[model samples]
Target: MPLTAALLVTVPVFLQAPWVRSAPMAAALFTLPLLALALVLERRGQGQWQQLGVLLVGFCGSWLGGCLFWGWFRLHPVMHLPIEAFALPLAVAGLGGRWRLAGAFYLGSLLGTACTDGVMAAAGLMDLWPQVLNAPLSEAPLLLQGAAIQVLHPWPLALVGLTASLLVFVCRRLWTLGGTWRVTAAALGTTLAVDTLFLAAALVAPHLSGLI
Candidate 1:
């Protein structure tokens, strides 16, 4: 999710006149929300840090492995799906921490995914399909592939950031306060929401044009 937010925020800066010479630094600074949950919910126990480290490694390793394996097989490489779905299981089994944080992470990842997609749309890189009605924001026709936004799109990318961040906050806050498995279940449910939205959009788009 942080990656999504970072990409959305950074891509537009590069598109503008000055170009973001310090884009990476700006990205790191802007990612405080992602790190904040970990900081505030720090566990205090015997070798807690060690456990956290292990959890991080295992979760990341599992996700990367899954992604690589899927991609190598020409599977439609998934995006936020793997990270959100597996992160909780890995953390629970490996680190044995509170489910609350896992819930937060998943919800945060969902928000992040939306932001990433929004940014990609704003940058003319991809299409959000059904929700996007504007021709400028509409995706490429079905036959096209890659980089749709080089025509100097006039739409501001800031809208993506603003809307995505708001959604993320709402989801994340709900996650922090929700029930144990319920939050996890909610995130999993949202994964369906995203997929359904995509499918509906693709079905409705004009057959001749490519989807962004």
Candidate 2:
């Protein structure tokens, strides 16, 4: 779990670096090593193949979604959030009786995202909240704008932590539902719920303002 967490946290940070960020293929290429590691680790476990399937499905879904929305269609990167969030959990839930594994993937992914954002904010690469909230819903990629990191604020951290916890709780509950359709419904609903909560917090809260 620790190794997995480390990979999850590190992969996003590495991919988001200015040079890699400018090169989409490089970012995708860098993810391969981590994906390989994840596969090796899961193969040693009980649900080895199932877990591997989950990882592959998640990666493909996220990559394809990114290509379609952020690349071909030119949608705002912010709009990709819910799709990226839904893909992994939905794949895990598809495993039917393996809610524990699904929950682990869901939590791990959220932890990774939060850790990446925190690290980027600390390194003065980006302002955490405004980059998310003020993101244009048209064609801009949020992290590539070269905006100076704004003054560190406490509220966004608190809000992010709160939202992460809430998402975990919701996912855990979703895992308890029976049937693939039920799980899918729960996963998609939770995705929208969390995204909405994040957007609302970023927009309505004064202390969380950014250059957007």
Candidate 3:
């Protein structure tokens, strides 16, 4: 379950990120097929496949939210969290039902995104977001690298350390609960890992960071 949840969190980085950039409507529409497959698996599949269906249902929510925001609201960095959280009410309601795993994964991913955005805001990187993203492709990498380097300063580095430590502690606590909480832990932990890698990429190879 943990491995599957982790892959679901990571897959969007490679697949959805670029796809949404060029074809937002197509990316958004793809949710139908994903949800269809998920429903089919939930009805006909057993054991692991059934579990994957539930997770895919959750992924569809996240994927759609991402496509909406990155597609149209990318320039408005401040709207990122709100747009990505469009399914918050539904996810919360699903928590006590059979789709608890889906809720867990979505909530975990949302929490990670919140924390990342909070850290970025605190580190003063939020102000640079539009500039870096809107810059010409050839120039964006340098801007992104500069933004990544800014985090190396003492204050931003301290903020990053504190946030990372807090998230790790939360993940460890969630891990102790077992069951669906483990799904939450894995999703959150994988998101943190991905954010770390993205930062590294922004520093060393910003063009590959997928933000552009």
Candidate 4:
């Protein structure tokens, strides 16, 4: 269940990422249906459905955050995390309540995001963010590929390895807690997996990398 919850975090990357890019308003509005579904499931009164509902509620927060940021602030690299963290306060408060599942998942995803952005900054790829995004469609892939290649340099590669190791360590520790912590662990682990795959895609096939 925790692993499944973790994988759910990636759904938005495939669906919301491109959708928000093309139709920010529509993407933002889609949050309503997701929230409605969550409410319905929670009200069903079955344990399994109620749990799934809680996970979906967490996913809704992530989905809405992505839409809010990628919709209007894609070009501003600096605003990315701040915007993505729009639900931070709520997520934190949800930690000790019945909504711990939601809190764990959101925080895990956010941690993954923060780590990814930190790596980009440390690896000198931050400057390329706006450049690639604002470039012509034909030109963006090349710019993205160049940025990925930079990751192969000795210093950047070492930093990537170090950051990944730290995240893995955290995930292992979280897994031992055996409850919502498991959910957090799974989400964080899946996030790391997704980031690795996205970087690989950017290097080999930037057009399919989902950034443009």
Tens digit of per-residue lDDT, candidate 4, span 68-166: 888998888788899889999999999989888888888988898899899999888999999988888888888989999999999999999999999
Order of quality (TM-score)? 3, 4, 2, 1
Off by over 4 Å in 4: 210-212
Worst 10 residues of 1 by lDDT: 12-21
Q: Write down the TM-score for model 4.
A: 0.96
CA lDDT scores, all candidates in order: 0.38, 0.43, 0.91, 0.88
Q: Estimate each model's TM-score.
A: 0.33, 0.38, 0.97, 0.96
Q: List the residue pairs that clash in candidate 1.
A: 140-210, 141-209, 141-210, 142-209, 142-210
Off by over 4 Å in 2: 16-20, 29-77, 86-89, 92-103, 110-212
- Sorted on lDDT, best first, the list reads 3, 4, 2, 1
Best by TM-score: 3
Q: What is the lDDT of candidate 2?
A: 0.43
RMSD of each: 13.0, 10.5, 1.1, 1.2
Instruction: Please provide, for model 2 over 1-212, each residue's C-alpha lDDT reduced to its tens digit, 9 standing for 90 to 100.
Output: 22232243233323343333356565545557655665555555455465544444344444443434433223343444454455565655645654444444444444434444444455454533344434654422333322222222465445555655765665466457543333333433444343444345444443322312
Residue 80, candidate 1: C-alpha displacement in angstroms = 6.1
How many clashes in each candidate? 5, 0, 0, 0
Q: Write the per-residue lDDT of candidate 1 for residues 1-212, one digit (tens) a residue.
A: 22222232223223311222224334333334434433443444234453343223322333333333322321222343444344545555532454343433344344444555545555654533322322332443432212222322355335543554565566566556554433433443354345334434444543323222
